[model samples]
Target: MNTTTLLFEAPGPRGRRRCRLFEIISWAVLAGIAYLVIQTLDKRGAFDAAAWQPLGQLGVWRQLGVGLLNNVRAAVVGMLLSMFFGCFLGWGLLSGHKIVRYPCRAFTDLFNGIPVLLLLFFTSLALPAWGLPLTDFWFLVIALSLYSTAVIADLVRAGVQALPRGESEAAAALGFSGLQSMWLILLPQALRMMSPALVSQMVIVFKGTTLAFVLGGYFDLLRAATVLGAYYSRSLLQAQGIAAVAFMLINIALSQTAAAIDRRERRRYGVPPIGTGSRSPGMPE
Candidate 1:
């Protein structure tokens, strides 16, 4: 075998030429598209310096800060609630009793199937008619929590179910109750194994806070941008671009933190580098 073929099957000379041609064509197409977009935006005054001047104002910065705080508050509350309730529902779904498990399973399926926007609308609008008068802040949090609860419940369930059967059996042999074994042995391991996924869900929860703009009462970053745009006499493009940068910075930080934690966890557990599947002996068959 050729030294060059050690890592993978070597491409023939014609195949290599074809690959080079494809790469060149793809880059050229992408560059052309980018140039067109930049040109169009420039023509539309999206790059105007005057429109972005308001971003330097103290009052404008304060408004953005308040909006960001509201978003953070809702996301944090929802994430905590989701983790708590999701864990309970996940454990219930794995219970031996059909009465406990079936209801949890049904609720998970129902909520998970519903769109997040619909959930937010239902909580914000319909709930008041149903005699639950919630403020927009609470409504947003509840809506996000409800949707994330279903998703996190499924993640928890999969995490727990992925454990080896012997772990449970050994606990039973040691005279531990099923619940005790789950609490003492299984839940902790499952949580560690699923930490990366839970962090991802938290990021989703935070991003979903943007949809609170539809509620009218919630003053999130997007809503703030819209208000600023109106005040600046049709500077919507500039305000929106600033808002986009804020979101990009925040979500990028969150994603990087999550990735770092995941890498550390994988290293600690000696998991594979690509990290999709488990290499641990304790994992389920």
Candidate 2:
């Protein structure tokens, strides 16, 4: 209650009544939407037993598992590369040298404005035309990595900026160089504070693998679902439903794992789980 009141005063009786009315209206609206959707799906025979039966087959799951593996493989590799380049570019964006900062700034502005779909298309077509024999997997990974690299670079910059200015003063008093203070002190706290946002980006990375369907010959989950639908004849919806569920489950697992690591790191390093201007892990307070 105290924390809630910090943002604004606690709701009075009339305000609480109004909130209750709003909740009731919102639920009623959602219920109406659910009923309409169910009716539409029923009219389309989406609930037919045959349409959903392939979901129970072992072979169907095996195929999905294979495609899901490709999605995970690309997403995992893309995220790693994004983080590496994101950090490097992020650091470069803050560099004292115009040579480094200007190029990094230009890179971020240029790539960040372009859509990921365009990047994927460009990579798929341009690389092969340029006589690079890279596989479609590399094409997809590279595209996703390029866009996320800019986003994460921005996150890094914002994270550091959100830190209190006094941290820099303290680092200076301890005779640390600007680079030393940033790399050792500011970046760590900034990353900790940005952990939740990073996890969200990881989710985006995984979902972006669906764009691989456009590249053809890729075994991402969407393609695998298409193959399954062809095999099962009338079960495309079922296969797609399973794929959606799989994506959701994996995303949930990723978020939870990230949260666990953030918690463990904070506890191990004797820092607040989240807050402002804290020292890096293992640094003397």
Candidate 3:
């Protein structure tokens, strides 16, 4: 093949062109809808001086900061707890003994089957009656941790399974104990393989924190928005717009951060960057 043909075939220029067109079209459609909505609201006096006065007077920055603080607290705590529990459960599942592995798998599957919001409500209500200090924030964290840990465990397990059998055999031949083999030879590689999946789980937990409103706490962005809407029923449209913007910002930030982390991990592992001059397994250089 000629150089141009070779390069184009390697990266599939046609496919890339199609993808770019699709993204452009999607953004155009979204912008058109947004413009129409804004126009509609303006025509209905929803964006008038009096209607938007509450949002302006409420200090948008202050409300945003408070909402962000609450979200960060719940997301960070839940992510930490989820990683801790997930690592332990993942290790247990690979313990080679049915007694330990079966129970770990069963518990992970059990929690994975339930919805996170329902789990939060149940734990918040039940634990308080049982004398646990289950605040709304803590309840949300627990629910997020439980649900995310189950997913992380499965990802870790898949990572472990992806390793070459020769690595484990070599560790055993070198006189390493089972635990030592896992620590020294298995987990490090497995974690690297699972980094992308774990980041996705973290994003899910972060988004799930919005469900904290169910427990009547003021520490959630959605709850704060709901409170604002109730107090300013006449300007519900503006209040909802603010909430939607906040959520969209949060989701965008998270997605970008996760993508950065994934790129860093891929580079650290010597994997080629996506959409660049990289070779896949079984492909010629």
Candidate 4:
């Protein structure tokens, strides 16, 4: 039996039958919903071949692909910025000095709590209004960076917190300065431990690229789809559907990568992989 079975009783034969019944019912309900949706969309001529014609045009895809590249660029730049600032902010949160701690806490709480769209407005519009005009590209990137940094800060702090207390104590005993210890010892290990969370957060950053549509300066994938829809009204639904599919595929890839990293970390750290019956020493049977 696996650890899960040891932890909780497995269902009996009758329970399996009930589960099968539930599965069937769920599928039936979903099929009914799908049929209803298809009928409604058909009434609106959404399934007409003309409406989907734009998807066949090479130019439409080329435009969307360019926009997709922009989305990737923004996500990459923004995520890098977040990682950089978040490392310092994470250190600030953990610092002994009140001067560092208070400011980091305030910044983390402030941005983490605010809606990202508001930040986009501030970066893309408010700054320009105040005579700090930034390109739409920078605006989107900066907004994503600001919004995601707080989350990355929490990830860093959590990684550090998860380390054995002796790690820091050992550094102190070796006559190392605080910064030296962090740079030479603590950060490397902490980053490895938190790699999975950090990778998962990249998915969030990538998804946030869609918010560029509201700010109107950046030409993210969603914005491209919007323009295509406006120019070809009949293709609106198809364009949106395609964009949704693209997002789903990318997010799935990111999620799978995170899961793989998590598995690797578990093995490297000597934790029993999920579904294995093996348990660590002192784990209750």
Compose the digit string of candidate 2's lDDT tens values, residues 70-160. Answer: 9999999999999889988888888889999999999999889999999999999999999987999999999999999998898888878
List the candidate 3 regions with Cα displacement exceeding 4 Å. Answer: 1-40, 58-60, 267-279, 283-285
As for candidate 3, its clashing pairs are none
Please list the residue runs of candidate 4 whose C-alpha ends up more than 4 Å from where it truly belongs after superposition: 5-22, 272-285
Candidate 4 per-residue C-alpha lDDT over 166-283 given as tens digits, one digit per residue, 9 for 90 to 100: 9989999999899988778887788787877888889999999998888776788999999999999999988888889989999999989878887787778865332223465436
Error of 2 at 255 (Å): 1.9
Q: Is candidate 2 or 3 superior in TM-score?
A: 2
Instruction: Find the 10 residues in a row with the least total lDDT in model 1.
Output: 272-281
- Tens-digit per-residue lDDT, 1-285, candidate 1: 121214477889999999999999999999999999999988977778876778779998888788888888899999999999998998998998999999999999999999889999889889999999989999999999999999888887888887789988999999999889988988888888788778778889999999999989989989998998899854788778878888888888888877887787777876522223434434443
Q: Which stretches of candidate 1 lie over 4 Å from their true place?
A: 1-16, 173-175, 272-285
**Candidate 3, poorest ten consecutive residues by summed lDDT:** 272-281
**Which residue pairs in candidate 4 collide?**
none
Error of 4 at 114 (Å): 1.0
Q: What's model 4's TM-score?
A: 0.88
Better of 3 and 4 by lDDT: 4
Tell me the TM-score of each prediction against the true structure. Answer: 0.86, 0.79, 0.78, 0.88
How well does candidate 2 match the true structure, expressed as C-alpha RMSD? 5.0
On TM-score, the candidate that comes out on top is: 4
Model 4 C-alpha lDDT versus the unseen true structure: 0.86
